[model samples]
Target chain A: MIEDRPLIYKYLRHDKKFPHVWCGGCGIGILLGSLIRAIDHLGYTKDEVVLVSGIGCSGRLPVYVDFNTLHTTHGRALTFATGVKLAKPELKVIIIMGDGDATAIGGNHFIHAARRNLDLTAIIVNNNIYGMTGGQYSPTTPYGQRATTAVYGSVEHSFNIAQLAVCAGAVFAARGTVYHVRQLDGLIEKALLKNGFSVVEVISQCHTHYGRLNKLGNQIDMMKQQRDSAVPVEKARKMSPEEMEGKFEIGILVDREAPNYLEQYNKVRQKAKNALSLQLTKEEKEESERREALDKQ
Target chain B: MHRRKKPEPKAQLMQGNEACAEGALIAGCRFFAGYPITPASEIAEHLSYRLPQVDGTFIQMEDEIASMGAVIGGSLAGVKSMTATSGPGFSLMQENLGFACMAEVPCVVVNVMRGGPSTGLPTNPSQGDVMQARWGTHGDHPIIVLSPSSVMECFTLTVKAFNYSEKYRTPVIFLMDEVVAHMREKVVLPEPNEVTVIDRVKPSVPPEWYLPYEDTSFGVPPMGIFGEGYRYHVTGLVHDIRGFPTLRQDEIEPFLLRLFRKISIHFADIQLVESFHTEDADLVIVAYGCTFRSAHRAMVEARARGLKVGLLKLITIWPFPRRVVEPLTRAKKTLLVPEMNMGQISREVKRVNQGMTTVLTVNKIDGTMITPQEILEKIEEEKK
Candidate 1:
């Protein structure tokens, strides 16, 4: 079903490290496809790009990509990506994380990375449940969803990831579901092209654990649910909050230019250089004057 | 040859942390990630200002866990990287520290110690983390820990820590007590050309043939930095030569054994200790970090009183320096250990002495340095 599949295959490490661990009927493959297409569209060479991932199902995506990939500790993809971007700002750094990996254990790093406006594109796959660890409830699990950790059904509220990103001062924030392949690809490309901290939350499905435990039909039914529940931000803005209760808003929620951390840091470097040079000139002038005084004596 | 600005050779008054930061820069560290904690904050602050000037990157991570994670990432991206913290922050870094060991990622961690089981004291000197530096990370893997007795040693040992980490492909801990961290002393830093620097050995094989963790003649595989054309997997899972996770008994055993042997075989070069006046002595003071200063003074006074005494100052604390300590166990001499904590390294001393000599511990845990007079009194009382 993938058009230009041969072109996309060039971006994958299929020969050595393929047969990825994602389950069949899982939406991670579709979301990962969109991300690959986005990078491909941006014309970034494999050597010029780095994909950093944390632990979980989505975190395994970088393992299959043909870039300078880093598989880091759980809930720490953003921190690692920050280091890569700061160390070599010319490289295109992208981070892949899961719902639990991004907003739960790694929530502090997520918000701070956004607050600093680091030049990174973070894609958090929101499968609602922690799929890798036996379908436990995560921060993005809906209040009434059933998980292994929430057998009777969770009473805790789920986070609105896109809104959270905007609140954390991300220059670009967008949401797309795996069912909306074309739209998700477009959103990822825009996020990547942005020059500051960007987050694109892709609502994906884990039919094996999340669907079976919740008795949500099959994988196709889960995909249908995603398609039916997503409302464009433009339409959601015209509607009331109650109308958006059970649905999520897709499309960019925040897109604005702001000075990224590295750019500001470069300015600091320049200022320090100027100050040091000025001090050196003053010292040199005084030294020359002292030499003249010595000659006169 | 292109012209380069030469740094002037001069002795300047510098704090221990500042010297450490300078040492890291001289050792080719281009990235530093750390969370600010007392007794270790100056290292981060100095790096934050100096790293930028040197075109290096410095990041204050959200916490110590992320700090260590970032250091690993930066190191993998072909930069010498490090982080600094005190006791409470060190506790948070144990897991990632284990990841670095398991993945065989070379990085340096500077723990400027303060009193703590948990946040016990922030701005006080404590040698309490000596044991934690060795066993804090949950694993049986070997680690390198270097303790510096003075500001100059802090700089020299930090460079040594980086060299050992790069040479062995393991994490090295630069263990500094708060007394040494904050105390200012005149330090003559070696010019860049004067000091020895070791870089990670790069793979000679092509990208297609490179194995990230291949066992070679020296047991250390040549590491290829990311984006340098060699791409390979790295994980905390016990992996084989190719750096991919494995569960086979044969693969796991060889991989694990190689990691242990690489350091154990080099024990002669790894273990660094200084012996002072121990020949023909009935008493020897076993000390490390800041406590050694007091122990040295006590040994001088004890000898002045005509009691046979000496000091064995541990410059390298880990791999336990067994070769040096093993001989002391049979010398029929009293091993007096004075520490800032109740007794941490003393336990190791007693274990190594194995009842051959009386291992007496003079420990203080009141957020204060163990005075030389206190060590002298303990030696007198023991003699009586």
Candidate 2:
């Protein structure tokens, strides 16, 4: 409630629970600022927006926002968002989840939601490790990276979330890192405005767990790595595959137009209604003809 | 193509699952999310075609968990929502069921009872889920579970299920077995105005003053719809009156107590039992779901042979209807409990009876329903 604060503060909960639960210098906090700024820039009423999140450091984001918020179970934010969007299609719903939440326990819902192409925005924070429950490896953890469960380094490869969404039929898919705040805001704003399933994979830092275990220094060092190794999609396409082996692509990877669930269902409703009316008219005509025949008799 | 709404035919031969879908429509439920499962799939199938005609939305989700999740989401967005599944799918829905309980989301989950430890009998009937329906979720949360024995009760009780769910702001379980779910019978569909439908109370206060979980004299607070300017936070975690997650013991204790107390205080309204010929009978048969039909038939056969027998059919399964059952134990000398499961509800009867009367049970667990002959034999054995 302090005056002279940033306009983004208008979207934050001013009553209580001031300091957030995310670790100091956590990339999740940075992403929160970007999300607020993006929503503010879009000029949507707080009442017309719903922020849903799943269990993780990111799940706590909704409680701090002034908009209608729901903190759902682990990995199930998108499913809930689907219901909300279908029921109240006018509302803009943005879902937030960690790497494990979106691709691990909730992986089935994620891919299916994209395939269904519901108009929802999914913001996934890929911290490479489970930060809330300590230093456990996540589905987006780098191959051969150290975690609490991976004392000898991980053997499984990581999921490129943006590419997964694109393959799963999302109309809009983009990747950004916390180091590129301006670009992250733009990606989020675009995803929010997309008319079909949209996704923004945020490569973030978890210095307390993933970074500490993997010897990635502090939050600044991890952010510096994101800036150095990340390549724009256009630039990466021109470079040789061997030259960009360890680097990741950033920027809009896919943008296309398709009918969202609500738009398709509206047509389904109209068709079903037309069929019913036709059936009713046929029945009514048969009844009238039978009555006239009876009168002639 | 706008046209006048027409009332359905007064009398028709309908399957139990078909009746449930009709009941949901008449009861003001506009959102349905479910997966295809045996015995229960017909409910979803019927709704998928019926909902769009009424401008309602029906979604076939990837699994039961997401179906339950979506139903909750729809309910939170100010729509009446529901899902239907059988045992295996119901097992997958337990966690989300608990979430609905904690979040106080009003939705109906129809679990068509099939034999199961793990996909035991998909096409057959069993009352084994009686206990699971009561305590399937992993918490001490309160729930309202209703069962239907015939096609007519399938329609009427489903309407009642939605009423209680909306009034209590809690999930209600419509427990229908395969026998009753598939059985076809003549039911008189009520006119639009005949059946009473209850909607959740909307917040009367302004948006700024709305507290989602504020404790009131009745322990049930008003609900505000999402995206309607009443911005609030909802979570599965234990939350305070403001609906924000709380770790303080003071807020947690009050929140849990109010949830339980809201249902407990309204036990008389929540409990529904059908009594037949119990006034002058010395022995009574307690049954539910499809098994109630056998118990009723057995009672008539026993009465023809000059044995005084009565039937007490439980329409509301959870909260146990202890008041109704306890009084019968005091008056009746012998109580015969016959069900498809070993002894799920009989144990509840014994706990309430407290050895006041002999509680004899006829258990059957081979994926077939208990027969009237078996129940009559148990009654005859008690006489001998």
Candidate 3:
């Protein structure tokens, strides 16, 4: 078999200490599968891409696929990813994280990176609950779910992932869930190919933790809820919020062209080139040497 | 003695911070990001004036983390880069320093250490961060930190810091005191041609074969330009040498051990020191940074009084120079440690002693330098 062709639906054999502590039938694997397919479709040589993640179930993504991996502090993956993008604009930089890791702990960085339109893709495997640290309530946990922190039904309204991305100035934003996994993979491919901050928020399952805690029914039932809940963004515009409440939005939310961060920062560099040329002239050299001798004495 | 060369003229009287900024430029630093904080503010102020002269970018970031972040980013872009701050701001930069370590990004961080835990004596002299420079970020990572004892050392070490940062693919600490940061010492900077500049290792292979974390023959991977044809990933994860994230027990174990041993294997080359009056010495005193000034005076005075005493001042603090201190501690009957902080280096001195000799500490945490009289007094007490 050609090594370049990725066999879809095959178990990923990469990260050893990983898929750690996530409950059975967790949606992380599904999102991870889509990410692999997207990269496969893009034909990114594994060595040429860099994946950065912060702490949390989703943030643990850097562990799985063999790319240049960075697992930093919570909510800090984007900041580090920005460094990677700014440093090496040729690198295929991507960041993967969970709901709380991105919108919660990493909210400020997320917005700022979006505003800058950095040349990187952000795939938020938002499974709703904080699955890594014992099923705690996350920023994206639905308003009516029960979590460790929110022992009673949650009162805080959930953030609409696509809307948040748009408001944050994301050039490419979209939503996909585990049930619509194949389309999710396609969205990731599109985001990876696009310039600037592209966000694909995959609505995933958390059967062992989130589903069990909130009494959101069995794994199959939770899967059905996600499938039934999403409405297409174009259709949602026509339908009322009431009609869109229980429907999933399955395609691109915001896709447009914008100047990426490194290209813009390079403008300052171009301007600096002239100043450097003048500073390094021969006359300036003799002057600096004479100054050095006097200072030494 | 060799014939004296003609004395060249002093172009301008620049502050130490100005010299540091100029030195960074001559060393090819094209990116400088910093936030204005006490004592070290002149560094940011100077960079603002000098970076424009060389067409380099000077950004006043929101805080120290972002400043250090930008420096690391800039270095990855194949630009020499640095950030400067006092202790308070240095604390804020600890997290990113760890990021630089885990990802092996090269950059310089000039920490003009002042007295305190949280905003302590921002304008005063204190060597409180000598230990923090080695062990600040949480983890068992090996670090190389160079301490600049004089204003001239500050300028020279700032350049050296950038060189080491680029060469080793690690963050090099320029641990300066407030006194050194603010002091106006005449610094004669070399012309850009006279000084050697080291750039980050660029990938030599075609973009397809180049992994950003794949170490070239130099034991450090050649970094890729972000916008170029290279398409490798870089992560802070314990990855295979190829630069991707991994969780194979095979991957994690080796990744961690390599992360630590890479520098440890090269410890001797990373060590730096200035030793004096150590031969035939009956008593030896160890110190570093600003305290070396007073320690020098005490070492001279003790010898003048017909007592055998000497000084071992460490310039490269991390890799700790235990080899240098260990022999002296065993050979000399008595050894004393004097520093501006409360017994930080003194603790290390005793640790290396292992009961072969008596190791004592002379600490002063009152935001003042430990005077020669104080160190001499300790030597005098040891004499009896």
Candidate 4:
């Protein structure tokens, strides 16, 4: 099964650089591998691409990837990526980071980026814990989950990312867990190919810290929990509220056609250009040309 | 056949902040995100009108946070980007500032120094952010900050801000004072070709073997754009060369050192300052931001009377031109530090001087600049 990702083997320049930033038994590598697989399947030429990241343990993802990359400031990867996107609309912009990065600290950007529906794919690796800053409870940390700040269990309600993205006008939204590696890759690939804002919320695990505190213990056990708890979006949609309780959906939750923010923005721009051009008439333009011709003599 | 060389674009009297905006455009900055703030608002105002003219994007965000967010987002998308704000708003940008350092995003932030620990002065000049600009965030970090003393310098350095930001892959802070940001002056805008520009490094290696964190021959690694064919992960975590989240005991130290060294290696380009009349002067006046303009006037006054007084104007505030000050400490008998705030640059002066030179401070907190008369009086008082 690992051979399924010889694509990963070919990409691995130095196996020494790996074991990567993920903790022992961490699920981030699973999703990280899936991300690589999706890129390989799409056969993107790595040179022209740029990956921008916000702060958090997850933001570290870009440092490892070999390409034009940026590990941006906290919660500001979207802003930086937005700049890169607008500067060279020819380049592909990817924003990857943890829950703390994409949500709490970067929440304002997260909502606005979706609202604008910019042509970017934001892959949020929701490890629930702010691993880099120490396992602090983030906006996506489940209610009653024990984290560093939420040692007594989080009293705050967790956000449903897929629904929030949908409300924010993202053209595509999906949820995945490391347990569903293949499905996660497919969703990421689709999100990458999509023309507008696309978000794939990958539920990840931090075994060393998040697991110990929550009593989820060990890397492999955490992976199983995610597997058992995830209900397909379709299955959950058809199920009763009682049946849906305690089950997370893993699949493309909402995918639809929408005008990208750039196109809409460009339209406003095109209108201004046309108006300016029209203000100069064909008769006057031709007369001006004839005058220039006469002056040439 | 007499040919007129298309009237060399006439110079215009422009606001300092407006010149900064024009400078940004000339530097190839195609994305601007900023919320209007007094003094600095002219920058956003100018950008709003001009960005579209050149096919660039300008977004006025709800607040300074979103403005920085949008700026960072746009930059990562492969655009040269910037956002401008004064003290209060600059404080709001600190968290993201830390993020910018951790994530290694190249960008430019203009802090038109107003009064503050918090909302101190909206329209006044203060060098108070002198320390805040360096250690504002919560961590061990290295930052590149450039302070401009005049309207023309504001234009020139703002463009340099973008170049250094992209080259270093760090958010370069353009520290201009309220006076500098608002003061109007005649500026000759440079042609695009005449101005030096730096685009981010393209991927020199294949994507498969790419480690976004892998140190390049230049210390900084190549940056891959997001939507292009290459795909990689980026995080703010203390990780290994792979750029993934790591908890290795050995990772934190080297990671930070390299982060610090990346900028430190290019200190020559980063640390910029100018010394006028320092050659045989008995006294040296240390200043930056809007205060430098006043110091320049004071230098002329002192020199007219043959007071042997010199002025050391700081152009790059961050890697604090140590050599410039170190020599000044040994060569000069006294240093007069005049600033809008109680004493910011004064402390830096004292630190480098090692008490060898008496560091005099002409502190102003009345929401006004230290005048030439005030600085001259302070310099003469040091004589007695």
Error of 3 at B367 (Å): 2.7
* Model 1: per-residue Cα lDDT over B14-74, one tens digit each: 9999999999999999899999899899999998888877778888888999999889888
Write model 3 residue lDDT over B31-69, tens digit each, in one string: 787889998998888777667555566766657766776
Candidate 1, after superposition: displacement of residue B136 in Å? Answer: 1.5
The candidate that wins on DockQ is: 2
- Between candidates 3 and 4, which one is better according to lDDT? 4
Worst 10 residues of 3 chain A by lDDT: A8-17
Assess each model's interface with DockQ, reporting 2 decimals per model. Answer: 0.42, 0.56, 0.22, 0.36
Native contact fraction per model: 0.44, 0.75, 0.30, 0.64
Q: Write the per-residue lDDT of candidate 2 for residues A1-297, one digit (tens) a residue.
A: 133147657878887466778889899988988898888889999999999999999999999989999999998898889889888888999999999999999999999999999999999999999999998999988899999999999999999899999999999999999999999999999999889999999999999999899999999999999999999999999999899988999999999999888889999999989988999999989877866666666
The C-alpha stretches of model 1 lying farther than 4 A from their native spots are A2-4, A14-18, A282-297, B1-9
Candidate number with the higher DockQ (3 or 4):
4
lDDT of each: 0.89, 0.92, 0.77, 0.81
Worst 10 residues of 1 chain B by lDDT: B1-10
What would the TM-scores of all predictions be? Answer: 0.95, 0.97, 0.81, 0.81
Between prediction 1 and prediction 2, the one with superior DockQ is: 2
- Judged by DockQ cut-offs, is candidate 1 incorrect, acceptable, medium or high? acceptable
Candidates 1 and 4 compared: the better one by lDDT is: 1
**What DockQ class does candidate 4 belong to?**
acceptable
